[model samples]
Target: MPDLLGRKFTANEPNRVYVGDMYLPACDRGGKNMYLATVIDAYSRKLAGYALADHMRVSLVIDALAHAHGVRGSLDGAIFHSDRGSVYTSQAFRNYCSSLGVRQPMGAVGTSADNALAESFNAL
Candidate 1:
């Protein structure tokens, strides 16, 4: 609920901070849409987890975070930053973060600066 990271997208150690975002990869067929949610460890500068689905629901991000948990074992005392998207702000997501002992900070609306890292990752 707060700007915890304050645009400082760096972590001194792994699992301290994670940035995530969703993007739609180009599809040649164009019959169906696919969305990808990714989680990157800021300290390691590596992809910690990701999920691909035909929808951009809260589950997409949840799955990605879950994958991070699975890979990292525990997400307690970690900070997860993202844009003010509906899925990120949904109650389901908030509850998921709480269950994992993670703090979720969302950037201001209409500005990508606060979520630059994840936005850039999605662009790439």
Candidate 2:
């Protein structure tokens, strides 16, 4: 997969680009785990949108993207970067991105540095 971000996390304009990732709690109590999907602006380092759910399904990611789209008001030609997670690679998510004119960019598999910003955000 090509890196649409070009390993550049900074952008001149907002809403034109973003990076996203999913974060799960360190421990799961009672066999229950909560997932947080977040989209952040590359230029401002501001959180565009986020969603929390008990599952890490595709819908969780979709909802996060939807929320980002909603908050941004428009995402046409926006570049969304993420890791090679199944939810981000699912056909449904691809279709959703296509329908919204958002470009999905994936970094190298198993390379956390490719998506450092999102990982950094998750660390916080």
Candidate 3:
């Protein structure tokens, strides 16, 4: 759908809302670089889930979401907000979210402000 997170930085409950993003580590080891995918709860500002891997593939994001699902027990009707990255826009990730009864909301292209919370989290 649209930018569900929009500019509002609050959620009514914990597991019902989350923001996700992928970032590159600062220290590159010269070899294959690693990426970090993080999902944070909007209500409590708690890290719902995260995954680090050698690739920024769609599976990385799926794994992070799965981790969040595992920790939260359920993500039914949860809104997963993220930027318009290919990994987030892939059909596989979309199907995965649908299977878990999660709603995938994407931010505008090239607009970091659309996903400010997740971006801010990545900064830290």
The alpha-carbon deviation from the true structure for residue 30 of candidate 1, after best TM-score superposition, in angstroms, is 7.3
Q: What lDDT does the true structure give each of the candidates? A: 0.92, 0.91, 0.91
List the candidates ranked by TM-score, beginning with the highest.
1, 3, 2
Best lDDT among the predictions, by candidate number: 1
lDDT of 1 by residue, 20-101 (tens): 9999988523577899999999998789999998898999999999999999989999999999899999999999999999
- lDDT per residue as tens, model 2, 1-124: 4898767899998898899999996767578988999999998999999988889999999999999988888888998999999999999999999889999999999999999999999998
Which one is best on TM-score?
1
lDDT of 3 at 121: 89
User: Cα deviation of 55 in candidate 2 (Å)?
Assistant: 0.6
Q: Taking the tens digit of each residue's C-alpha lDDT, what string does model 3 give over 105-124?
A: 98899999999989998998
- In angstroms, the error of model 2 at 43 is 0.9
* lDDT at 118, model 2: 94
lDDT of 3 at 27: 54
Report each candidate's C-alpha RMSD, comma-separated, in the order given: 1.2, 1.6, 1.2
Regions more than 4 Å wrong, model 2? 26-31
TM-scores for all predictions: 0.95, 0.93, 0.95
